[model samples]
Target: MTYTHASPEHGAPERADDVDDVARILQPDGTRVSDPALDRWISDLPPHELRALHRDMVLTRRLDTEGVALQRQGQLALWAPCRGQEAVQVATAHALAAGDLVFPSYREHGVLLARGARPADFVLAWRGEEHSAYDHAALGVAPVQIIIGAQALHATGWAMGAQRDRSTDVAVAYFGDGATSQGDVNEAMVFASSFRAPVVFVCSNNQWAISEPVTVQARHPIAGRAPGFGIPSMRVDGNDALACLAAMRWALDHARRGEGPAFIEAVTYRLGPHTTSDDPTRYRDADEVERWSRRDPLARLEAYLRDAGVLDDSGLAEVARAADAFAAEVRAACIGAVTRDPASVFDHVYAEPHAPLERQRAEYVDYLDGFSR
Candidate 1:
């Protein structure tokens, strides 16, 4: 969603459709804006923690670039780039407690990393080396869901389970603006509302859903849809790391406190193609990309940190070096990944061995033996 400054000091939406109450704590120019309602959530963060957020964004971006490079090099089948949506991804992940769970779409690499997934775990699925790259149980994250907004239903169901168990854990569902139009997402919201499930719906409205613009699918702010489901919602400046963090913290807290499900529309932009197979240039204008580039989340956060004396030139250099090192490690890991046995594909089909699955697995192995013969 676009916005117009109400005054020289603050940004205010010119129309209700623009989400008149969108929360913004940092401007594109790196100036900090006071958000009375949301500020307290992140007020206790120290300079070091703030710096960590910057580091995570830089690292996540580096990982994304590496993924694209690997895919282009034919090392991986495909990759989803999360270039400009780092703030929303990283901040929302950080908002979760260790006990909380996440059901994320394919593009949430930042969230996976934040939740303790290894670099190898990020690429194994893309490489076709494994059905699932990470141990979801250990990470408290579900396997990456590629079927659009289906993860929303999974999250809502899990939240209902947690509610029944009387656990404080919140289930968070992360998807793009495109997913909002999906029936699964809408149904998930309805169920979550009816049961007062402890879930947070984070819709990263990154302008485009693949080649389709958000404007094409929805007439008003995506956040506005939540009210109809009896869910409290907020629209936030996804490019502003602090604002994203604050909004996520607020949503998670609300859910964790048994306040039912909450929704967040993070107004961000995708600065790259949807995936390795996508050609964004065909649909988006170069000038539009240039315009959003000025609102680069990483750059503005870096600027804010530097201005606040949290990170000087040396510190910034250190972060760059660290990100580079991490990316190199990830690259090496992806390139040298051990290929999984083909027959092992049948291994995780069910929790325990089933007669039909076992018979199929045996037949599959026999077929492989025939190939050898």
Candidate 2:
């Protein structure tokens, strides 16, 4: 079921149908807008809690910008910019409990940050020095998956394991709009629903999958696909920090209560290129970027904070200072990543080496020794 609100700008029906669409809490202009039911949820949250949410959004954006800068400086091989989707990562991650495990696609640096994953470890993989930087046991965050939708299966399987142990802890899988096209993601939804696993599937629908628009992935809204897999779903304004938090909290509550999996498709935009490699201007228009810029998540959240008296000019300045310091630390960490030893490549290939690999390793060592002489 969907709800339709008349467009405040045109006075015409903003949305013709609401079959799979969901209402948003914060409007593009920074007004505290929301559906009656969801409004109560946010209204009930403490003011201090709300301010923290805003802070996370600010820091996440800074980290994303610094990441892109690192890529340009040749500190990292590549970077995936989440320039416009800070709210989705921050709000959703804040909703999760410590017991929950999070499986993230490569772009979910914000989620990793919220999960207490060190920024230094998060960037090491991108710096081409390590495949995974954090110990999963310590952070409860799996290594960033580069194979797109594959992490969804890992999340679902983990949730199934938790169910067998009779644990109420849930699992959350983060993926992009483009990942919806992958078969493993579909299979994950199937298994989660069939076994009633406690999982939340978060689709950060940033409109563009690399250069391809979401239209190429789905004929209707992506949220509509949830019903087919027997999972309830909602679409929230990805740029609205408050709404994203409320929607995520709702989904997390449902999953932890043993209500099975839930899906959240955050309707947002990718304000930058797909990564450092691609130029968006070739396929998308500059005007489109300008249009989304007006709806900037950081600006909207600041407006709300000012209206609530939780943030003044001094508070804003402090946040900026904090962000600058954090960015500098990240830059330093990237520059100081340790170089791997030449023989380290074969160290972790096997706990008990097989005959074929042992033979290959011996030959490779001999070849390298010959070069040294």
Candidate 3:
């Protein structure tokens, strides 16, 4: 099987690089900033919608934490954490309509959760039960593509087909900083730009490609790379929920209007190891972690909510209780998940039976029967 890691993807070299300012919609203090257009966008949202965004962020973070804990405890063989990057996933997901499909990297639990995927189903893949517990067609999401940067190609192709179908549906590809270095990503951007495909590429630049620093991949910000490919791009504070949501809205609109692909680089930090398999202490320093903690999206949004009268102490408590309960249910489901049947391995491989597969299955069954249960 192919190894998958958490990340968020890139193309064009014929055009001049026009990347400059990264748009910001929410200040660190929760105050609105940046373009008046973005300000108006947020103003148009109901207060309840704003609160729901915060709620999604909090719960998604909780799910990330739970997944990490389960992995550490040996409940999961491995896991890719989305801990510090909740706002990037959650806020962007909130901006998508039900019909808009997402081609996500392996670490998009926040996006799936915001799209109403069951918490238990989210953990099923990491638990090694099956490839995916969630249905792709039903959820308007593809299976979390484990091959780095492959989803970009898938999204671009999907967008091309959607355009032909005269469908309003948009396709999104989410990957990490490292994926920008991959050729598949660059090629995907080229196709999307050439076809004017309704695709949006989101790069969650958490500053680490596994253990390597993102600085090693590019000296300039990742967003800057998109302009060279003839794609308009935006960079935003990934930890800022409002900024993430606003940027996504801007990109979605541009793409839906058949303006072609848009790229967003959400600058943030991954507060945890790249995966449960990684030892971050060997690479990242404690000071760096602490620095990111101060900018924790959850805390920033919470402070904003309290000051803006969107949430009070009681409201916060309710969010906490709900998240905790949901997390527990996820844990229980993981623990109680049925073990994969060895015989079932032959299933889902092909739509039809073949001689080789049948022979292999027969041999496997015979071998199994020879053993004492």
- After TM-score superposition, the amount by which residue 39's alpha carbon in candidate 3 deviates from its true location, in angstroms, is 2.0
**Which regions in candidate 1 have their CA more than 4 angstroms from the true location?**
1-21, 369-373
**In candidate 2, what are the lDDT values of residues 77-189, reduced to their tens digit?**
99988888988898888888888999999888788877776768768888877778887878789878999899999999999999999998999999998999999999999
Task: Tell me, by TM-score, which candidate is best.
Answer: 1
Model 1 per-residue lDDT tens digits across residues 1-373? 2122242245432332253257899889899989887789998989988988888899999999999999999999999999999999998888789999999999999999888888789888999998888999999999899999999999999999999999999999999999999999999999999999999999999888898888789866788789889899888888888988998888888888888999988988899999989999999899999989999999999888888989999888898898899888888888999987777898878899889998998898899899779
The per-prediction tally of clashing pairs is: 0, 1, 5
Candidate 1: clashing pairs of residues: none
Instruction: Give lDDT tens digits, candidate 3, residues 171-243.
Output: 9999999999999999999999999999999999888899888877786677777877788887778888888
Q: Give the TM-score of candidate 2.
A: 0.92
Task: Tell me the deviation in Å of residue 128 in model 1.
Answer: 0.4
Task: List where candidate 3 sits over 4 angstroms from the true fold.
Answer: 1-21, 369-373
Computed on alpha carbons, the lDDT of every model, listed in order, comes to 0.88, 0.83, 0.85
Off by over 4 Å in 2: 1-21, 350-360, 369-373
Candidates sorted by lDDT, best first: 1, 3, 2
